[model samples]
Target: QAGTALLLLVAVVVAALPAPSLGWGVDGHLIICQIAQGRLSDAAAKAVNELLPSGAGGNLSSLCSWADRVRFRYHWSAPLHFIDVPDNVCSYSYDRDCKDEEGVKGRCVAGAINNYTSQLLTYGSSSLSPSSKSSDNLTEALLFLSHFMGDIHQPLHCGFASDRGGNTIDVHWYRRKTVLHHVWDVSIIQTAEKDYYDEGAGEFVDALNKNITGAWSDKVQEWEECAKNQTACPDKYGSESITAACDSAYKGVTEDSTLSDEYFGSRLPVVNLRLAQGGVRLAATLNRIFGQSKA
Candidate 1:
């Protein structure tokens, strides 16, 4: 058909373009941050505002993907964005599992969270004099938290060592050449919510905010409790995602990489659950750090 031919042409054109800097994609990051903002405590909200740039309208969600934007500038930080776990290990031990390209231990997303959290607390204290460097550091920490929160929840980010987080396992999403990680990072969300693909950025975000369908409402408390504990550390997120990557992220791969409808349907719930969990945890983290009382 003529329509089908046109679509294939478009797909070819898109596939030729440069690949996006892989996070949860722009929409996924925005949705997570936006949801967190709504749940922020008054004290937490105030604290977050003090750290955000004035240009951002004191809105945390607006800067959700700032880390990825500054990735090339802060090249060393690229490794801190993800964890590489071997297949079926299904566990994260900061002492054993954390690593980066430079063979640095404790240099992945979980470590970044711990580091920024420490920096936030240190720079956040009333004892320290307010200086531009400290202020800048605090802002950077906030941005990292905003972005890393989204990254940790993406199953592929915690993927196996052999596949480079599914990057090496070649795949295609809807006839376009892509990798397994790319599918989760880009296509799954779009395929699942294709109706909103053409919608304006804000329109899609508004739709996500309005839709409250997921398992997060029940698990927010439990997840928050787990995150609040210091000993849980990497396992709180990394372990869970790696396990899921083994269970769900690689489900549709075959010789042709044609993802069937079943794969999309099954993963849609996962996409939603991960987003919800990331949003709730982001809010809970800020609440504990900046709320009326610390955990």
Candidate 2:
């Protein structure tokens, strides 16, 4: 009986763990699809095609693969000095409002670069080296970089001080004790499935592309503004405040409801827009490193 109870407890604990969240927008995938489809300068298209499997499939998974690899190769060096710091601290700006000094770091951009670089160095180096040009690890690193770059851009992935990037903050999403980060990661993907229903990869690609062009500027501006505003630091950008904002923004909506036109409605545009920007920036970064001009 005692062994059975322990097993059950272990199962419960495992079940309660949050899922991995990937900070991606629909537009990111859309831009990849557009680039794949459009007139690429032979070299750029060839590079993209090599990254993608069949030079098709513009789904989130495909795009994520591309982004992960790109980011892994470029930003791996920046994060080694900063990951141990709390998200709130990392996101905090002393210039804006200095409250608790315990967990607060500096600003999000620097933090993001730090966090991103750390993940890359840890994962990418073990997988590939920057000096080697002709190894499979290099390929893997590029893919990891591609996905991680997108991940860091996500405001939440930079993390929050209070809840460990929403790990601790518990809330009910349709009665389940879901954390803010997990909700953004899984629930949002589930929601995307329900709304803007796409049966085929082509349709999915089309949807992603259409939305990406529409929202890229706004997403970049949002990050840029946040970077510029001193007041956007610790006090306002803390984990608690971010958690509250996410809960308020995306609470009751479920997978089934999300599929409906009324689910996310127009708000969905932001996803693709961010994705597009990430992709463009990612490609640009890669070109610079690989001795290729930006496409």
Q: What TM-score, computed on C-alpha atoms, does each candidate reach?
A: 0.83, 0.49
Off-target runs (Cα >4 Å) in candidate 1 are 1-21, 126-136, 196-216, 231-234, 292-295
Candidate 2 residues 1-295, lDDT tens each?
9999999999899668643333444334344434333423455444445555554452224555454333335554323111222433433343442222343544233344333333323322332556643334433444544554454434454454455455465655444566655554444444555555553434545555454456443553343233442311222223333343344333453323222344345434444444444444445434333323222
lDDT of each prediction vs. the true structure?
0.76, 0.42
**Candidate 1 lDDT tens digits, 1-295:** 9999999999899778766545788878887898889888988888888889999998888899889887767888988888887665766677776778777887888898878876676545544444534443788998998789889999988977777788787766767887788788878877756654464446655555555434234555676665445522445788788878878987546545777577888887788778877887888877767753333
lDDT of candidate 2 vs native? 0.42
Pick by lDDT: which candidate is best? 1
Count of clashing pairs, candidate 1: 0
lDDT of 1 at 26: 80
